[model samples]
Target chain A: MNRAPGLKTYAVIYLLFLYGPILILPLFAFNDASIVAFPLAGFTTKWFAEMWADPNLWKALKNSLIIALSTATLSTVLGIFAARSSVRYKWPGKPVVMGFIMLPLVLPEMIVAMSLLIVLLGIGINLSIFTVIMGHVLMCTPFAVAILTSAFQSLDRSLEEAALDLGESAASTFRLIILPLVMPGILSSFLITFTISIDEFIVANFLGSGQPILSVYIFGQFRFPAKVPSMLALGTILVGVSVVLLAIAEYFRRRGIARTGGKDTGGFL
Target chain B: MTFSPDRPTMIEFRDVHKYYGDYHALRGINGTIRAGEFFSLLGPSGCGKTTLLRTIAGFEGIDNGAVLIDGKDMAKVPANARPTNMVFQSYAIFPHMSVAENVGFGLRRDPRSRTEKAAAVEEALEMVGLKGYGARAAHALSGGQRQRVALARALILKPKVLLLDEPLSALDKKMREHMQVELIKLQRQVGITFILVTHDQEEALVMSDRIAVMFEGQIAQLADPETLYRRPNGRKVADFIGTMNFIPCQILSETGGRIEVEAKGLGRVMLDEDQVPPARGEGEPVVGLRPETLTMLYPGQEPQERAVAGRIDEVIYFGDMTYYDVFIGGTDVEVRLSMRNVPGRPVLDVGTEVQLAWSPSALVLFR
Candidate 1:
């Protein structure tokens, strides 16, 4: 049967409630008044232009870029090796290893962030972008691995065997054939990890020091009302970039899945 | 016990014993394949035909046997390093690649100029009758086109041997027949040893120069298709290769190298001891008759003397032919005969009692 019209209106209200504040941040960055209120005070682009001129903002941006890039590269590489090895051959403790690699995906981020924080402090390793990278890798590696595993599994095993039958060695076959076929998956994994590293706040909050990432910096900017609109402008930019990166990542993911004949959920499932 | 000192043997399985854990896949298989001949390893799925082909292609490693290619031991030879290519059952054409790239992939094994590669790709595509269609992605091609692309990819490399694992199993009947002839033509043009693994009896019969019928990881019979069908080694070979009606029989007497056997359903009849000598005294005697070997006519209507009495239970007319399932002396025997439209023909309907007759030599007596 059909739902009532009131319920549909309620559902729309709920969706607006979720995104209303974040959407307003971009709107008010262009507002004329410095104070962000229900009635947008006036019209101005001073805050957005100032966000560009600030030297510290540029340094913080550079730092975040370095961490996210390293996180994307390192996590994706490690994920590829782990995924390929796990998929191609059956070995003892394979289930256990796979479970361990995937454990971070299910475990609460708070628990993981705190545990990793404790371990670094216990090992006398000072908190920095390196520690932050380690944490991001821990958080994002599972996703990268998960992405590549399905791509590898969806492949026809005979394709590899046919390569062998034609006289390509195991390593050469991987380099020339298997790698190219799953390039979409690898690209998706890289894009996904970069987005996660860029937007992730919880682990970066606890682990970051000396040079804080963009997320922690944004959080630090929340305390001062004078820097409020600038942070919103900055956040507006981050939100836009994250949305674009995530959209690209999702596009690659959906295309990869469709190419491999996998189910497309469109995030509903 | 001298090996061939002439042209190299394309492939050999030397005492190959393969095991998927405890289940034995291949057992002590030792055979040499002559170069440039079409040989088929024909059997049911679990009979290790595909396993044998994969072993030769270096896709599978045996538990005990050595797979040798061109007389060289392929113990540590990985798949790509082996001078053998395969057309897989699914026709593993790279979905992301265009037809040209797929056929040209193996040609990149050694460095070549781009012009040479392009020329070679064009020639290979032309060989498969897909010359100008190289730019289309593999998924866009039809099933038959995909199959040709796979063939071109494997054949273009000029490998020492071409292994086909149930290559035409995915195709429809008409397409399969056309491809079978096309493959044979391609094999003749390329002159490489083509080792086909298939379970389809008609496919094995219609294509291969010689078929090695396997059962339970062992070669049961290896012969040309006609000989294999006509002179099957055992009841299993006879039953698997074609349809033959079997009946329990008792040997009543023996004379002139012929046996008078009393079929459970038919009275005393003389059966010829043909290619397979009838061991009358050993085991339970059985008589096998091809359905086509018997003809049904109305009672007392036989021009000659020999006939078995029967009543037609069903006559299924299938366009060019009709099959009459007849009940003769309490036995249901299937009699297949050609249906030709001639004037004043006998219209034998259901419940029509008739006499089925055949030459005694048509009876394949076995024990």
Candidate 2:
């Protein structure tokens, strides 16, 4: 097949448009100037040092880590049960129930945040990191379910039956066969949900109020012109962490496919 | 033919009936599988052959009737507790485990020590001709190797009855034929009753000592391969097993346990009681003869007993044999005659006049 130069140029332009801002973040982070413009400034690690020195940044990072961890664990646990049941058994109103469970994905996050705040306050619950965690879980669960469902769907039902036929009980068969086969799916779900929860802004802003959540804290720091350089450094670190996490997730997913001798269906690489 | 008292019954189904919502999966299934016998449930897809096999394995529940394994009712027994293990159609070799781990899986609850279990897995692998393959990951093996692993894994438990749900269906033709012979030898070596469910008639015929032909959730006929091929009870049974040319015939007279039928393609012939199965329905009786039963008499060759004049309608040349579709005695019904391709013999062309040799005893009359 002949390659079209026009199509190649279009692809290059599209990718540059997508990654251009992300590429500039690191360039400005390492540049020795406060302004994020051209005419390249000299190199410096001082912005990274300044980022590390901020106590509020550390507190916000801790809060975001706590929310991400909790949301990932909670959603993935729920996802496993949902995905397994959806794949294995037929139940009454299955589509409707699964649809409702996944509704938060399509439902506007701002709307979910606003309504959750109203409900929580109506129930006399105070705004805290806990509320923000609940909001994050609701937003992240659909993604967890989507990934886990694919994992569970690819599994052969005969593997479970063969385990039982070989004298293993239901629980033992799950532990020995089912769990190990779908481990990559669970890992993928956890990482994706964790990433989503950490970067989510609306839920954090609506539920946390004055709480030191990373997204909300970052928005506040944008008001200070001097703090933008250190924020760029923080953004560079986040981009690096996300790339590494995604790489690790894709590695496990591919390894799982190889171990099972299954055909490589494309994943979210 | 009923199972005699001399051979002990390993698994018996007494009026077994099962339904899946509105669909009748198995209806009033009654049969006996003899001890140390290679039995097969043969049928087309959705004919409930696999369902019947799963009932023996206790993977399926019977709505009414009882399934007995060694004269013990299996109603309350679960699949794991049943004295049967299955070689699944997919082979179900655990992809994450080594071949040894898969074969040793059934021994997890056994009271044997680790070394004894390892030795047993080794022996089982050897039985299936997969010796020294225990260390290899199951995912790395080919389809044939995986089937062997499944066979070894199922046999490791030494269950009273080994249920095979189309275990060789995944293999290619050559591998499937090879495994068919190996399975027969393995059954004889182990001396265990093996019940195989398959849609392949040749596989069942090649591997089983006795076969139960099923159609529409019922066992149409239960007999050995030769009997099934030579004398199917009804038209449906005759059609499913192998090729049988059905020529419309009229019953001319009925004598003492003898009936003479005037067939359309061939002349009148007398059929003994054994040659005529009991009438299953009120319809015009037809004479069924196998393709190989009708032979094409070549040049300089004589049919010592009997012969019919025929004109070749079509000639299908197989490498070893030639099938000639001949219109016998000016009749429109074309009876197929098979001739061996030997040296100095020529393939017959279409529209060639020929003589066909056959016997009356080989004809099965079905109403």
* Most accurate candidate by DockQ: 2
Compared with the true structure, all predictions reach lDDT values of: 0.80, 0.90
RMSD of 2: 1.9
Residue-wise C-alpha lDDT for candidate 1, range B1-367, written one tens digit per residue = 1213355577777889999999998888877788877889998879989888878777678889688888899999767677888888999887667788888888776588988988888898899889898888777788899889998888888888888888888889899999999998888888888999999998888888778999999887877787777767667777888776777788788787777898866667876656344333435777777777777664457635467777778888765567777777757644444444345556568998777776566667777
Question: Which residue pairs show collisions in model 2?
Answer: none
lDDT tens readout by residue for model 2, B230-296: 8888899889888889999999999998999999978899999988888569377899999998887
Q: Candidate 2 docking category?
A: medium
What CAPRI class is candidate 1? medium
Off by over 4 Å in 2: B1-5, B298-302
